[model samples]
Target chain A: MAQLVLSNVYKRYDDGPKGLFRKRKVHDYAVNNLSFTCEDGEFIGILGPSGCGKSTTLRMIAGLEEITEGDMYIGDIRINELPPKDRNIGLAFEDYALYPPLSVYENLAFNMRAKKIPEDKIQEAVSYVAPLLKVDDLLDMKPPALSGGQKQRVNIARAIVRRPGLLLLDEPLSHLDGKMRQTLRQEIKRMHHEIKCTTIIVTHDQMEAMSLADRIVIMKDGVLQQMGTPLEVYDDPANEFVAGFIGEPPMNLLPATIVGAGDGFEFAFEGSPLRVAVPEKYNPVVENNMQVTLGVRPVDVLIQPGTEGSGAVPVAVYENLGDERRISVRIGDTLLNTTTAEDVSYHHGQIVRLSFHAERTHLFDPKTGNRIRSNVEWR
Target chain B: MAKIELDGVTKRYGKNTALDNVSLTVEDNEFLVLFGPAGAGKTTLLKTIAGVEFPQKGLVKIGGEIVNHVEPMHRNVSMVFENYALYPHMSVYDNIASPMRSKLYKKDEAYIRETVERVTKMMKIDHLWERKPSQLSNGQRQRVAIGRCLVREPNVFLMDEPLAHLDAKLRHFMRSELKEMQSSFNTTTIYVTHDYMEAMSLADRIAVLNHGKIEQLGTSQEMYYTPCNEFVATLFGEPEINLFPAEVVAENGRLYLSALGQEGLPLEEDVCQALVHREDRSYDVGIRGNDVRFSFEHRPGWMAGTVYANEPIGNKVIMTVDVEGTHIRLVAPNDTRAGLDQPVYLSLNMKNAILFDSVDKSYVIRSDAQRFTQTAAAAGR
Candidate 1:
């Protein structure tokens, strides 16, 4: 396995012309000035929503799309003009692009056969990777007879049969149902453990990226948003978008104002009586009456049941989601949600105390949508 | 406003059966969700209730009156299909207003304008009022379709995968929005979706269907804690529950259940007595990921295993451990870090586990069966 690198990679699409004058060439950059490095044997995930340049970045790395301007490298060798076939990379996409008429074994062996490998070596390679993905028992069956999950397994098996230096997957689990998707996700993780090839996965699902990747590269509108470990992004988001995008149910971003409460400052919500003391780490970073957005995940919001005078808010809605409970309280027009593992039940109008964890709370600039880092250096 | 009931309903197309002997009752103004996989007859059941598809062998009743032969238009039920099915030529304003302007439910222009604006704003599609269906995004079109349905005072609302087209984040946001508005519905609703999260979050009651049959119909608590069968148990939780065959052994005076090559897994007194009285010596044990506890360091009464995989989802981590020959999965903290083939120890929380009869693959008992049996039995399960 070898490390992969991209320096100032850019992909521009010339839409060409507009408004009765076809003279000007309108250049649309799908990926702009993207640069990152994947160390040897490391697993990296490219994460973003649809049309956010994630797929375009993956295609550029695979040599499927031409780079408008940049340098690409695998280890120390530059590979900008290299053909897709010449690059030692394996690809598996959302669709199971298997040969319908070919048996599972033949479909896996087809790639090696085209490379002019000997028959015995081809059999050896196919046998080694087949059981890794649990497709060994279906070797004789054609692609038409397999289920969607089974077909995807075979597709992954075929990609890894040749054991290329790098493995690339694009939304590989998007087609399966929930249970089947979980099973395949675990299998893919196991396969990665067994074969430590440098891997890159492109997906819009944050769960998939967080579970599988050692580090994640987030993008938005052809611009790189942030790149870090899953926990790093979760614990301290670089911006409001990353904070909102990285979690399930997303994070609650409410507009608030910094007001003086004795010696310190408190975040006061608009049209509501809720006031939270600003965390001590941000003391030197803020001023009184500053407009900002307060970010807190549902899991960090704690609910306390009590009588009046203890700061209670009526529950707007309570959802029993099997293993956990999701409670929502309205703050003016916005509904702030909190997730808890407690088995307590609350009705629509029940009053409860809501509090946020001081250490886990975040602040973002409302105008720029950027995070406001603390003045104190924290790990 | 209305109660929905189906008695032994069966619908067939040629040799294929879409719904078979299905019986269900949805209380007045209740939000009942029909949840299952593809081709599980969820949509078919909804259609039968909407009078779009007639049952060949049974009766359909609304508000205790038999409506088996009623026409779709006369049923007074608003239905939203998987596809938007909006008027391509009209703007969003007119599409939402058309429902109020129908001959059977016609209203004055002033009332129509007021109701249309109110519904569109609630659906967050007010800005797209002048945009045609073709110019809207998939999410926008779906909102318009739902807005049209919400504008009328129908007895029942039938929605089929209304949030299926939106992306994950938008779907999540809209689900909460839908649930918040459900309290104001004050109308009987039958919603169909294959997503378990939505089914658990929104449904006052969930009907689990498989192969054109209702497997179980109950509250989310009953479906999670007291599932009727192994199939229903596997449908609720993420990472899925771990099911393995376990053998019961009675030593001296105490009984212990053994599996995964480890013997003497001490059971609680109630659980031990429940299994000892049974005639079967072998049964299936299902442990959810959260019920299985693991430690990197060996602890007393814990079984030794090898770390097979560690997947850290955003909120939590699902760690798979290899105990003997069987792979056991458990939930871990998000910051959990482990290397491949590392030694790990696991201990299952038997109190919360569900036991299934090995012969029929049906739930026998759980140690904490009383937690849900009271409510489930009261619901006439």
Candidate 2:
């Protein structure tokens, strides 16, 4: 296990129609100036939306795509120019490309045999990894005979059997069903624990990235927005995109007119005609009647309207999610959402008061969406 | 609004039964969801309701009247698939207006455009009306599909994962929008999805299907709190529910199951009954990670387990605790001080436990003797 690094990486493609054999260079900058490090035994996730150059970065690391510019290193090695086989990485992708003709056991052993490993070592390795990954019984089954989840497990086992210093999984859970995905997620987490390999996975799914990685690398349009542990990302999101992206039933962003200054102030929202108290930290930045974006998560936004606090907009629509009912309120033009205690039934268009926590509220610069300085205390 | 029904519906492709004797009712204006994993016949059920697929041995009814052998158009149902199936060449306005094109529709142009404009504004896509599908984003294209559906003023709306193609941000935005719109339209809707989040957050009631059969149906809370069996116990939530094998121990005057993993945790009446058997056998105990709590102290009702891993997700931490021979997840709050591989006590949440029989794997939670006796007396009287 070692620290993997990428420095100022870049990619460009040629696009043109000037001559029969001529082309014009188009600078796409797919991984422009991207730099990050995954430490020894660290499990980091590369997360972003579609077309965000995450896959391109992973491919570049795998030696499948040439690094257009800059240096790449695994541990102390300047391994950008090294072949994939020499780099020593266990890799898995969304699609499992297994040999249909080979049985699971044979497939696990084939990679080692190609390297001319002794039959005893191959069997030992297979036996060691098979039961840990819950694929011990599936060893004799061919690819066609196994279910999708089984095949994925075998694919992962194939990638990790050699005990590579690093592991790269690209959306490995994307192809399975919801239930199967959850089950495999537990198995993968368990596998990562027992064998502490430095892992880096690329995914567009925030839930996967948040749940699996020790720290997450968030990318957008080839630019790094933020990199931190999942707690750091979700609690103190760098901006609107990160805040909106991380949570289910995402944080409710209310466009507000910052009313007063001081530790205890009020924010009057436009459209929704609602107001909430702001903690002292936003005092200097908030100006009376100036537009600012107020961020409150469904969890932090509380009901119990009569609890001697600023109230929320009345409820208009409620979604009963069993665990929680996400209710929407119409306050002027804005819609505010808060998760009520499960089994609290409310009718549509019912008016209810909501109050945002002074400590839990977040403020962002309306135009840029960057997290503004605030006194809202958090973990 | 319409009441849609399926009776003895069975469809087969070669030897596989996509839908097997599935019968259900969708009351007028109800937001009903047919939710399941892929190939569990969710789409097939939706198609059958829309007259898209002919069921070999059943009748589909609209407004309590059988619509067997009826053409799709005559059935007056609108369908939306994952692709949206919008016409690429047609602008959003024309696409919305296309449903009205069967007749000359020249005189009805004003009415058509009005209704299109109404639904367009309602779906928040009025500005993109003149743009072709190629120019619009996936979310915008979906709105266009919904606009076309609304223009028809059909009594039934069948949506098959209409929001599957959008990004996370847009999906959340649209999830709420679809919920609000579906309620406002009062259209009898049959929504199909493989996403539990969507099913939980969007539906008035969810019908969980497995192997082409309705395993359970209820309000989202009922499904979450009282899953009919083991399959549902594990299927309905994120990070998944934890199923741990437990042994039954009958003590003096009460039923006490062995929970050595988290010692002294009170085994609720239901959990004790789930473990009850004439043969004194072991059984499975199903509890959601969110409901299970872990403590450092060896409280009387807690079991000791090793923390296998910690999965962080901002608000909560999912800790997989290994107890005995099985590993179960317990959603720890973010601020919990437990470290990885630390020996900890997992206190079973008695309030949320849904117990099942080990052999049959069915719901068999035992109620309190008092409640049972009361029900028995009431039945006798």
Candidate 3:
């Protein structure tokens, strides 16, 4: 195992012959001045939506794409100029890319054999990784005979068979369905624990990143937005984009303005008769009549009766999603979702007091889309 | 609006059977979802109803009329495929207006403009009126396709995984949007999806298909609470349901479930009654992840196990424990953490478990079947 370091990394592509005169050339930076370190045996996830340069960052690390600028090092050795095969990085992509006619065992051994490793050593490596991925029994079967989940397992097993210093997974579970995806996700976590290689995965699925990675790097529009543990990003999002992008139902981001209500100020939702008292800790950063965005997750919104003096919004949508009940209340043109596990059923148009947890509530700059920092810290 | 009925429909191509002897009725204005895995013939069932594919063995009826020989263009049914089948050359406005311009449903330019704008605004794509399909994102394109379908006055709307291509956040947002729009649909609908969450949230009643057969058809509550068999139960929940073989032991006029080397786990009165009439002693106990309780501390009557895996999803943590040889997964709070191979204790809520005949994997009994029926009845409304 080895620590990986990237310093001031930038990947830019030439946007050529596109100007009105067709003479000006411009460069579009897919990855903009990114720097991060993965400690030995650490698992990091590069998470973002499409065109966010997450895949570009991963490919640069794997040496598949050349670094447009900056330095990359694996342990104490700089690897920016090294070829892909010499980088000792394992890759498992969404496509299995396994040899169709080759058996699982043969597929695992194919790379090792191509490298001219001893026959006995090749067998030993294949034997160790096959059981870790739970593909021991399927080793004898050809790739065409395996199921999607089984093929993914073998695909990952083949990547780890060589005991590379770093493992890179690119949307490894996207092609799978729900049940199979969950099953394979757990297996990947367990496999990471067993192997403990410095691993980085690129995925658009927040749940996959939250579950598998020790730390997550959130990106957007070819820039790093935030880097933290899953809980850190979830509970204390640094911006409106991070807040809305992290959760399942997503955080409710409503445009509001700060207004004075006696001693303490309150946030008045735009175009709606809804107001929530601002937490005391945020008073230093916020002012009355200042436009802001109020952010709160569905789980942080509480619905109680007989508290209409507080913000009371009529339920516009109520859905029973088996394990949880999702209640959405209309605020102007958009709806704010509130999720609960209580057995109570709510009807549409029913007036209910919706209170935000003071500690869990978030305020953002409406213009900049950045979090308004305060002294509040989640315990 | 019309009611659709498929009676003993069986479709085959050479040696492969896409749909078996299937019979279903989608009431007028009711939303019915067809849910299963990839090859479970959910798409085949939807295609059969839209008159795209004809079944050789049975009849497809729309508004009490047999449509076995009907051409798809004349059926007055709008279909949204998994892939957004949008016109690449046309702009978003023209693509949505294409349906209204068809000969069967042609309308004047004034009405077409009004209807196109209304559906586009509702679908949150009103600003993309001038962009071609190639310029839109996958999510945007899918919404445009659905908007085109929504602009028509079809007797039935058939959608196959409309939200499958969207990202997690957008998919979640659109699931709510679809549920909100369903009430105003006022048309019979048959939706197909491989995602359980989409099916559970959108369907008034879900039909679980497996290997060209309908395993069960009921409300989401019924499907979740009292699934007909083990396969159906596994399909509805995350972490999959924990199914382990257990033997019914009778002692001192009381029954117990012995599983995973843990003995003397008392069975409830209702379960005992159901088990007394069954001829088989062996059964597969099915328990959902949330029904199992766990702790790092060893409490009374809790079985000991080793931590197999701990995954922290957004709101909750799914912790797996290896008890003896079986791995049981449970839902823990988000803050819970445990090291690998750490000692843990678990106790099953047997009252909430469903038992199946071990040999055939068919439903034997559940202690609280009455509660499922009540909730399902309420949900159906």
Kindly list the per-residue Cα lDDT of model 3 for residues A116-180, writing each as its tens digit. Answer: 99999999998999989999999899999999999999999999999999999999999997778
Please tell me which predicted candidate would have the highest TM-score against the true structure: 1
Q: Candidate 1 chain A, which ten residues in sequence have the lowest lDDT sum? A: A18-27
Residue-wise C-alpha lDDT for candidate 1, range B276-329, written one tens digit per residue:
778898989888888898899989888999988788877778898988878898
Query: DockQ for all models, in order?
Result: 0.60, 0.46, 0.55
For model 1, the docking class works out as: medium
Q: Please rank every candidate by TM-score, starting with the best.
A: 1, 3, 2
| lDDT to native, each model | 0.87, 0.78, 0.88
Off by over 4 Å in 1: A15-27, A307-311, B81-98, B108-152, B375-381
A1-379 per-residue lDDT for model 1 (tens digits)? 9899989988877644546755532236788889999999898999998899999999998999998889999999888999998889999999999999999999999988888999999999989999999999999999999999999999999988999888999999999977688789878988988898899999999988998898999999887899999999888899998999998878999999999844598888887887777887888888889999999999899888874553578887788876678898878557888888778888888988888888889999999999888877643
lDDT, candidate 2, A1-379, per-residue tens: 7789988777643333446765423235677778888898888889998888899989988888888788999988998789999989999998889898999999888889999999999999999999878999988889999889999999999999999998999999999876688678767877887888998989888888887888999988777889998888888889988888887667888777777754556887665446676667677667677777888888887665332335635566677664557777766545567775455766666656676676777888899989886543432
Compose the digit string of candidate 2's lDDT tens values, residues B1-381: 689888999998889999999999888887888888778998888888888888888889998889878888888888887888888898998998898886633328878878887888887778887899999866577778887887777889888898888766567667766666665566888898877878887776789999889999866666677778898776677667777666666666466555445323356765555555456456677777767778877776567777776766656676887778577787777666455678887766666665677888887663342442353245321
Better of 1 and 2 by TM-score: 1
Evaluated at residue A181, the lDDT of candidate 1 is 86
What lDDT is obtained when candidate 3 is compared to the true structure? 0.88
